[model samples]
Target chain A: MSLRERYGGMTRAEQGVSLFVCGFTALLVVALLTGGLTPSYTLYLAGLTGMYVLLSLGLNAQWGYTGLINFSVAAFFGLGAYGAALVTASNSPLAIPGGVLVGLVLAVVGSAVVATAIAIPTLRLRADYLAIASLGLAEVVRQIVLNQRDWTNGSGGLRGIPDVFAGWPVLGPLPGELPGLQFAEYAVGIPGLFRIRVLGFTLGEPFWTDLLNFVAVVVFVAAVYLLLRRVHRSPWGRVLRTIRSDEELASALGKDTYAFKLQSFVLGSVVMALGGVFYAYLVAYVDPGDLEPINTFYVWIAVILGGSGSNRGAMFGGFVVVAIREGTRFASDILPARLPVDVPVLVDVYGAIVSDFGSTRLLIVGLLIVLVMRLRPEGVLPPQRELLWPSALEETDE
Target chain B: MALLELLANGLVFSSIIVLASIGLSLVYSIADFANFAHGDTMAVGAYAALLAFGVIGGVGPTVLALPVGFFLSLAVGGAVAALVAVITHVLVYEPLEVDSIGLLITSIGVAFVYRAIIQLRFGSNPVEFGIPLQRPIDALVPLGIRITVHEIAIVASAAILVVGLHLLLQYTDLGRKMRATADNPSLARVAGIRTRRIEWWTWIIGAGLAGVGGGFLGLYNQLSPRMGFDILLVVFAAVILGGIGSVYGAMAGGLLIGVINQLMPAISNVAVALPLVPNVGPAYADTVAFLIMVAVLLVRPSGIAGGETT
Candidate 1:
């Protein structure tokens, strides 16, 4: 009892907070390693992980909270990217600053619109049925992006979309020239602080686009994390979970389950769209090929790998996915020479195998998924019961 | 005449969908979830034939040896795919049994692993049956409608397999047992039927037929890693349309989708009649399934063949 009280009553909520912090710390360690080894692409890939994290979190809201299996995360994400790009691209009526701001807002609203359109008709069916429709929707969207030359540029890809930093004049003299972000660096001693040492080896110097983007992503992730935590404690979230756990009861109580489900689905996709805008700006390009069903699966893999229902798990999953995906590229570079004196032929064969790591990574990821599902279906960090009211009741009679 | 040709083309594709959807229907009823990897099972069958061809090299060319080559490819494809199905069932699906959602995710996992392995064994490029390179076979004009050797072969093989499956499910004691297990596994188990044994056979037979279906699809379309997945949703649309658990429903659904997908792009009037649509109708070939799917769920959620909700 004493131990339980010491660790905040050994409550699930404290464990959740501690685990989340651990996940964040692990991610910081990874980010530092990435920056240390591959200075150029670290922050850029971190931004990508942020993008995927948001995608998974969007999915988590539907599948984790409301038990809706929507397989069209990639579609909404693509729409968000394309929607924002269309609004902000140089050729658009709304360009640069105004377009960027309006485009971001429009991207979220447009995603909500798309989500509502799909949800209103389809939410009545079984969850897996929605999966079927969404899968087809993705294919249709991809076909449109691929076939329509006039509208989507027909797979040549759309480029020249300005980043948020690019639109901001105060941070300017056009920071595109900087090698990387010098605004802050993850200080060595305390990763938990995500402790940034501002004036990163320089004064009044602009940061690289990747660095600027990474900082923005960190802020975005933090804000999203706080918002989701709030939602988790809110009445709306309670209603969403009620619909998931006991739909008949929720309906019996006069709560419109369909409307709530649709609302949650739209809100999740709206977040995905916001992430999509960041992704579009970070990459400065959008290709129809990038929006494959596999991309969605990859996000799902991350979501499940990190723990689907937990927000911190989703964030960690995003990092793990990016790490496995991008980190393996350097596998061949690290192998072959690094192993202690080996059988020459065996070394050669191993080298040959690792050389195709790009394709084999799929096999590894697939195996990881199977193992994870079979062993830990709840995810790496399972959803725990959180303690909302920690204040003890006062005794007035004494 | 253009419409007739399109319908004929659609029938060829429909036959494949019908063949694949049968296996999916069986699995859906018994396993109680959609298997995202089933399409990959199609790929598995096609690639098995490809591997068999690599080993036996002369399965093509000589007119006298043509039938021998075809049977060999079919046998090898079916057998290898059955083996793979059994292995994955044992390794993944059986172990993750409590929740259908876990099984669903596991199916996706198997699909990823299978796709990666297929790409590893065979290079990333598309492979074709030796016949596609041969001189164009004369098109048969039966009652003034042109049909290629591919279409005839597809239709005939699909007919034989469907009829074969029907007989197996209806006449044989094994068929009755399989159907019983599919309908209600616990009830069948209580009735003294070896439910596990029945499931084992279901995987073998269902996946075998799926292999054959996949082989036929690849025969006409050419085999690629993405072929199975590309056709996955259409297969789901067919299976769901046919009333998910019914064999006959799968066949009917396949043909409907096959025809609709071919013809809808040209005549999906809802999009065509609208102004400033940018000629999206022809490009909307895949969109028809999703539109129809949403409509069907709204009007008749159980499906056309009257599939009961599990």
Candidate 2:
């Protein structure tokens, strides 16, 4: 009962067409989000969404594809960020100069190490136990980072993470003649377009760090999306799906379910670590506060809400979460201006209340999670099960 | 002896854990899912007690009516906590049904909502019963050992609650029905046992104890929105160690963990006292429950008191 067993997977031509449409739509959304409403802030949000897209994609690989109840997203992400920090930050304990590429490698390696160590023993546990174990381990990871004062600087948080692209020869010089803040370059050529202003808006480009980091993120996200789509459609994806649907059946068929589960877990963690590295590089800072357990839950929410098994769905969920979380910051501007004849006293109270509407946003997110799971448990973008080979069902129906 | 001090401290914490873990285990056994929000139930209890005290504290005569007022606040706290816990199960969890993963995730949502509500209401700072607190009961003892009145009170109350629960489970017909439902719900239902009613009672008792535990815990530790979360993790450690479903196992396991949380840190502090070892700091001690939970789970995933494993 495979989609491949019915209709062969989407043809290359079909895939090409769909990819173009998705890309075009993504571009339009990016434009809408980045223009007029709060360009710099919107850019920051976009960069963050890209980072989370990677995280959710990683979670999708583990939970949606393999049915492993891995709750180590925050741990792996923190490790990645700290891993990057160790190599790249000015006061880092390590000797490595902050070459962005080297930091990424360290993050991926560090995440893999922790993932392997945690998975070796706990992978044998039932799903609920695994959840507990992973969650506990994540706390252990956070505690270790905090308590190991000599190593992690006692939670003051590492600073001065070198910008990965600011020093590049050609593109680095593009933001030339800037003073004080080295990264914020002035507008050029495009006049009003480049020099556009909004609340707290700066012209020309986002922090060169954000620009380069986001570019790098886009590249990574594109590569990962393409790669996941390929793997998800391949025979390997079939095996993972088999394990997800029925581990015993997969094991019975000699799929080595344990090994596969571990692989899926490590794979997901590695991707998440890469996200961590990107996040650290984009922000140019690392802190234990950035790696709370709540952040991991956010990634899981994104994956489940978007579409658990679908890479594109994961990205969509990432967008929705970031918009809800970050979009609220600019609500006063966008929301207040649009309101008709607001009561003066109530409006003042509303303004005061909306100043700290963070919990309000999360409440909505949480309510949406309950509602979505209750109504559309499969998510907004459920995974399509098209087959690689022409399916027998399709042929018979034809 | 320092050992006695640690033992007192251990017993106090263990009793609280005992109070909390029994409910956690009960839910895990009969309902068949790790109730992630169980810890929040404890927080709700403590905060509810705090609220009740705030309302009732001013009305009572200071000398004659304070104790009565305190007990009333405690009851109010426990009841409110239990009510909220039941509401969570009904509104959030029961809707998810047998989709355990979905229920689990939804519980995480519920935890966030609970924590956010507490934060919004109480703010981020820790709150306590501002009344001048008592010194250790062993304060007057000549052995140079100290155990606070709060500690003694916590331990005594825990013991009473444990005994009361034991008696209820062992001597009562409802207890038999609960045990039967927990053991085999389908079979109990076929035998004309009201399994759903038993489940309601199970949640009620579990949440009520959790609330009571929280109320008492706030007396010992300063109450905060995060108090339940930290305690809940440790309670989970105890529950898993005791074997998930077994009530007796959870009690013993809580005592074991409570001791380890306190006594082991005391031992480590002593070690640090000896000149050779450097100071690892108190935060290092927090990892014990997590380590023990993982290590115990590795050796005996079914726990020391084997619970249902499916």
User: What lDDT score is found at residue A153 in candidate 1?
Assistant: 76
Residues B120-167 of candidate 1: C-alpha lDDT, one tens digit per residue: 667568988776433324554544456666567778878888888889
Q: Positional deviation of A127 in candidate 2, in angstroms? A: 0.3
On a 0 to 100 scale, what is the lDDT of residue B288 in model 1?
71
Q: What TM-score does chain A reach in every model? A: 0.79, 0.79
lDDT (Cα, tens digit) per residue for candidate 2, span B201-253: 88889999998899888888889988988877899999999998899999988
lDDT of 1 by residue, A1-398 (tens): 58556577445644764666568657656645545344445557778888988887888788777888888888889988988787767653334356577878878888889889888888888777778777887787788778877667777777788767665766544465445434454455476665543223332232365566788878887888778767866898888888877899999999999999998889889888878888888888888977888888888887887776677678777877886787677665666643466887766545545767766778778888898898878787656543152332223223
My TM-score estimates for the predictions, one after another, are: 0.87, 0.87
Q: What is candidate 2's lDDT per residue for A287-347, written digit by digit as tens?
A: 8887778788889889988777878778887877776676666564466532256787766
List the lowest-lDDT window of 10 residues for candidate 2 chain B. Answer: B58-67
In order, the B-chain TM-scores come to 0.90, 0.91
Off by over 4 Å in 1: A1-38, A90-97, A173-208, A337-353, A385-387, A390-398, B57-66, B132-146, B264-278, B308-310
lDDT of 1 at B23: 88
